[model samples]
Target chain A: MLYREAGQFKTTYAADMAVFPIRQDRIALALLVAVAFIAVPFMAEAQVWPFRTDYMVRAILIPFLILSLAAVGVNILIGYCGQISLGSGAFMAIGAYSAYKFATGVHIPLAWLGTAISIPPLPGLISIPLGGLMAALVGILFGIPSLRIKGLYLAVATLAAQFFFDWVFIRVKWFVNYNSSGSVSAPDMYLGPIHINTPVERYLLCLSAVVIFATLAKNLVRGNIGRQWMAIRDMDIAAELMGIRPLYAKLSAFAVSSFIVGVAGALFAFMYLGAWEPLAFDINRSFQLLFMVIIGGLGSILGCFLGAAFILILPIMLDQIPHAVGIPVSVETVSHLVFIVTGGLICYLLIVEPRGFARLWGIAKEKLRLWPFPY
Target chain B: MVEFGQFLEILIGGLLSGVLYSLVALGFVLIFKASGVFNFAQGAMVLLAGLALVRSLDFLVARGIPMPVAILMGLMFAGLVMALTAWLIERFVLGPLVNQDGLTLFMSTIGATFILEGAAQMIFGSDVYPLPLFPTDAWFLFESAFPGGILVNKLDVWGGLIAAILVAGLALFFQRTKTGRALRAVADDHAAAQSVGIPISWIWFVVWLVAGLVALVAATVWGTKLGVQFSITFLALKALPVLIIGGFTSVPGAIVGGLIVGAGEKLAEAYLGPQIGGGIEYWFAYVLALAVLLVRPQGLFGERIIERI
Candidate 1:
């Protein structure tokens, strides 16, 4: 096959250490990028490409991006660092509502400017990190109990955070500025001259952010921090004996994870829904994100993206298939079928390959590299 | 004295509701003890069973069958389905996932929950059904010599009695029977029980089936109290706090935890609802349970676990 990488050779340490060291992989990556930028916009209409509806693109993808970011954050802690947390959604809600307050209460003219000034951004450029920082603060607080408990008990403690956050967000009117509707929403978003109200623009913004975060995550996992996290995940006492501070490693994982998830929540609210209630960030959302990380791959960044796309796209695709086939099924019927199929698939994937789609991808790559040679 | 009577009224109502909460939690504990898996789908199962009962009654009426016979038939059918569900889970899902970690099992249950919810909605339609319990017009209107008048519904008394009977029956079954002993052994240690010629898979199936039947009884009560609607599943969340309070492993613990949560929420609603713009009671039970979990992770009555690693 054209995927063979027989003659590729790394001449330098830089070349050897590159993200895509294989020549064929680099070519594939280039092709993927080219297709995404050039072909996708031309081939599919805006609606069909990202589900074609403005609300669908904005609402689903935006929240999905935020969730994916949060998943990455949780993945670092639970998957990489080996500290399980069921409260990632709580940190996300904190990030989202806090950002909403900042965006609205600051009283700036432009939406992006308002968003920027609300957080740590200077002058005009929006500071995404501020959202992460707020989430991180909450993450650390909830994560403090991890110092005492391990495994399932730790997960339950984090679950307490989830319930507490859910209760606080719904009960406290001040958080949503006493919005009588019991929901909070953000106005339109912008990045300087670029308007993010449109789906394509919003998708681009989210995609770019996902890429940046994913790259940072990938590198972090490959470096010393990743090893520390892996060490902690594999065995805490052994990791401690090996000189890794379990507390620092675990807390840092939670902080970093919460920060990513928090920013995602901001994006989810601002870019996607434009309106949401406390119910929007319920236990279901937490479960969905958790499913993404688990079914994607426990410790791989690429698995996060694959998992997100798989979970998000499958349901939408299933909902559309009934319509596409002229079955005339109601949306609810299709949704039900989607749940059945998705559930069955999850069961299948868990049984077949618990490592998730990422491991499968790795195996395929290995097979391609060794093509035509049995050994 | 009037305030004191009002408190008693609320306390009685809460205790009654707590019985139902404990029943639901008991369902969770049954499966959890027999198999190490936490059946998150317990709430959905409750809703499904309730809906099934309603649908069967409607079907029987449409077919001109007698109401009493129809109701009995429906109960029998529900028990059969629950047994089938147990078999399916043990043979296909849980069997393969036996050695998987807790998180994987958790996700699987969540997936199963979604499937069950969707299936129930598809089959039952999204309409609320009326549930009728025995002696609908009974009430105990006692003009007490106390300062405030406290009135008790006869249905509440019946509900409490029935709940107690069911709990006792379950306890007896778990304590006296050979199957119960086998289940308890599996609950204590799956490998050791299996080593002694106990069929772990069969026990798992039997326990799940028993839990399902319990769900039917709980569903009947819950449906009568709350009406059978999709939102009925939300009541299942009430059981989570119960599990936390009772400890996942204890039946009596579930009962006590349920009573506490039930009473706690009622008292919160009665006393604190007005202060917080009315409805801290909605999440009040969970808050109380969470506090308990924070203080005692193994629950009030759960045995202390000694982790090797």
Candidate 2:
């Protein structure tokens, strides 16, 4: 009965169009945000029961938040626009390396023509979004093929971007600032004078970014452009006939998606990994994010978070379960089992509910609205 | 003259290596043509088949079984394993997933890839097992034309011959066999074929089995060349560009696509890699495929895509 929206009345168009039009949903969202921002950090600081160790905050939460951000990006393109991409990893790499370049200071020596240009290092906060912008630019370039290619063919075509970027980052010394070993470490990150040093600060940063990006994504999808994307996805020929320019709809999806994923990549490299090589953003990373989008629910903002948590936490949980239960399994065996279980779960989920966890959540909510009663 | 000979050598080498890719691509073409599911698990299947064959062969050899008999038994064992895998996949994964969109099926096959890769490695042991079935030596041609004759690998020649035979056999099968007609019928229209009393599940199973056996043949050459290991799965990635270039549906398209990709990448790497940063071979074929896609979205030999509202 509490879950029912019976008492909620929209007095204005703005109220009706609000993302959380249901009073309960709005309250729940506020509570979640508050818990994330205040309670979780405070708990970690105070060493509360579940937060007794920083491992949860450092290892699990940070990666989960960052990856969820990336999944949100992938979902926009694949889920909303209906263009399949297997090159999200390459976009991530581009974001990361470009951010690294901007953060460290770019030096361009026109030695062949006897001129030199250099950019002084920018702050970490500025470089992160800049990295996303850079990724967006490249994403649009790679997405050009989608105009001609569709479906599985388009997906395979995106691999060109993945492999090409992989080679660029590995072969070009400039991207890494000519580091002797070719791996680059994150420069000290600062917001004005505040150093984002601790896991709590990193977690908060990711939380805020995710909130902002997700809201923006939600609004975009609910607006005219999102409709255009959905139209194109549902039927491109009909969409085109209705004056939805496939070029604008498809490319904009790429641009926005890559921008968000790029920010996630920057955060991932700077916050989670700290020190990384090109290999950190390999094709497997692409697959991982895709899995998150798929398992979470396509075309749903809430699904990104659900999917990310499921994909990221499942392996860790699986690893811990056998150990906690006193089963002596080798690390190799556990890893293999993780693969088998993950694969099996993907198949199972696709067969049972192709829309993913978000749909399941929706079903549960509908049931809740009818709790303690029946027709 | 020396440079020309070297260029010819590289071209020949690339084309031969491309044949190995074609063998793997053949598996993809078979499954895709019949079932319309792009089998991302093709490379993993190759790995599984190779591991099964090599592991069993080693076991039989260590037990003092005669060499020829052991090879025969090992092939049979691997064939049996592939048959079982085909049944499991068709019955469990693809059967329930019937009538779903192609993308979902594609994603499920990817899931199947992960499962096969993990299970094969876990069961058969993940260590690289060498299959030294082919001779690995070099031959020189046109000795009088250049300072040294154009170099060619003996193994590559064997691979070319095997690929030609495999393609010929597949052609004969498709053209002459009753099952081949059924497969074509199913590929043309699944619903119509079903209505005509064709067993869709059985046809899918046979296609997958044929694909699996083709993977066995590929694994034999590739395992002998590079040794069977986890890295063999990367061949699936390599074959994708070939698939797109050749067209997803055509077998002959696969061979031609492989040749173009192989020769083009090797040529680019040799001629342009040094000028750039090298390792362009990794992306060359894909970029070539992208270029082809721009020109012919259906692929060079692929059927023209006709979209409906």
Candidate 3:
């Protein structure tokens, strides 16, 4: 009864068209944001929460945001456009390495720089978008094959892109700046007196970036382009008959998806790892991102975040569970168990709810709305 | 100038290596033909079998058992374990996930891949274990009566011969056996086959078990060549291009595709490595397969499938 929205009514078309049409949902979202912004920092500073480590914040939360963005990007193409991609990691790598190059190769003023940069000028902010644009170009190039193939065949074609990018990254010395270690990294950005090097700072930056991109994505998904994408995803032939250009819609999906993924890649490089090789963006990473999309919810932007959190946070939680229970198991053994359990869970999730965790959340919300009057 | 005999030696060795690649690809084809799922875990299965063989040998030797008895027991144990795995997958994973879309099934397989990899690593330890198939001193020398000589190892020849025999036996089994016919029927159309009285789950289990046995043979050959290592599992990615070039459903296509990829990759490394500052061969096979896919995605022998809108 407390969760019922019986008294709520939308008087305007604008109210109905809003992302969260229900007044309750808008309030809940605001409260969630408030808790994240106000409560989290205070709790973290007070060390009241158990997961207050700097490393966890930087390594886990930052990467979580980045990967969520990438997952959203991939979902647009694979879930909405009906184009299967095995090259999401490649696009991410392109974004990362390109961002690294721009950050290092270009110069930025100290006043505009964040504290992550020791150098006088920092180009990291500019490099993020540049990396995304570069990834988009590559995504479009790889997407050309989609014009001819569909389904599993298209998937294999995308796998070709994964190999091509992996090879290029490994073979070309110029991309990695001829580093003997076969790796490249970006310097931290600085904004005058404030340093973005700390985990808290990086997390904030990633959070803001994710929010911006996710908002833009939400708008985009509701717009004309999203309808065309969904149409193409459901039936390309029908979409073509409806005057939607299949080539344009598919390619644009790839471009936009890659662009977001690229930005995430830049964040991943600049904020996390700090140093990475071609092996870092291997096929395994591609699979991990794909899993994130699959388990989170295909065709839903909110699902990306849910999937990323589930895949990323679960391992850490599992590993720490033994400690919480006072068990003396070694970390290695715990990790192995974590893998098996995670695998089993993934299989379970796929079997039980292939649409992903987001769908479950939707059902829960619906149940909440109709709690008193069971249909 | 180098002698013509030297070129022949490289060619012979490359072709032999190609045969072993075909053995691994064969394991992949069997499951694909029966279940329509691209079993990415095939390489891991091969690795598991190889590790089990080595571990069993260690266990038997520690117990003072005879060498031949140990070998036989190892093969039996490995086969049994794989059969169990097949049963578990069919009953729990595949049965529940049967109605899901293709991508969901694909991701599930990937999850299976990681679980297998992690389990193998944990059980076998992270060290590379060598299983001695034959005496190291065994060699076959082809001496040129003129002056220079070429030497080929007997083990390499054995690898080639064993691969050929296994492939032939598999072909005969599929062509002549009742179970194989059922498998083929299931592959043709799952619903139709089920409606006609074929137990879909049982067929899936049997095919996976067959795949597991094939993996054992592949493991022996590959382990003999490269020694069992974690990197071998990644070599399964090599089969992706092969599956694309050879057609997922064709056994002969897998053999031919494996040969082309194995030989083509080695040839690229040999001829073009120096020109490209080396290592182009590593990914060249996949690139070639991708190019071929652009021309014929149905592959060399795959049947064309048209979907209705």
- Per-model chain B TM-scores are 0.93, 0.98, 0.92
lDDT of each model, Cα atoms only?
Answer: 0.77, 0.92, 0.80
Off by over 4 Å in 2: A111-114
Rank candidates by lDDT, best first: 2, 3, 1
Chain A TM-score compared with the true chain A, each model in order: 0.87, 0.98, 0.90
CA lDDT, candidate 3, residue A294: 82
DockQ agreement of candidate 2 with the native complex = 0.69
Candidate 3 — what's its lDDT?
0.80
Q: Across all candidates, what is each one's fraction of true contacts kept?
A: 0.33, 0.66, 0.44
Indicate which candidate wins on TM-score.
2
In the predicted model 1, the residue pairs found to clash are A47-A52, A48-A52, A66-A264, A73-A257
How many backbone collisions does model 1 have? 4
B193-301: candidate 1 lDDT, tens digit per residue: 8899999888888988888888888888878877888888876677887888888888889889988988888888888888886677666776676577667777898
Q: What would the per-residue lDDT of candidate 2 be over residues A1-375, giving only the tens digit for each residue?
A: 789887778899999889888889999999999999999999999999788999999999999999999999999999999999999999999889889889999899999989889889999999999999999999999889888778898898788899999999999998998888989999999987899999999999989999999999999999999999999999999999999999999999999999998999998999999999999999999999998998899899899999999988888887889899999888888778877877887888889998899999999999988886845
- State TM-scores per candidate: 0.91, 0.98, 0.92
Candidate with more favorable, higher lDDT: 1 or 2 = 2
Name the regions of candidate 3 deviating beyond 4 angstroms.
A41-53, A106-122, A191-195, A372-375, B1-7, B99-101, B134-153, B307-309
* Top-lDDT structure, candidate number: 2
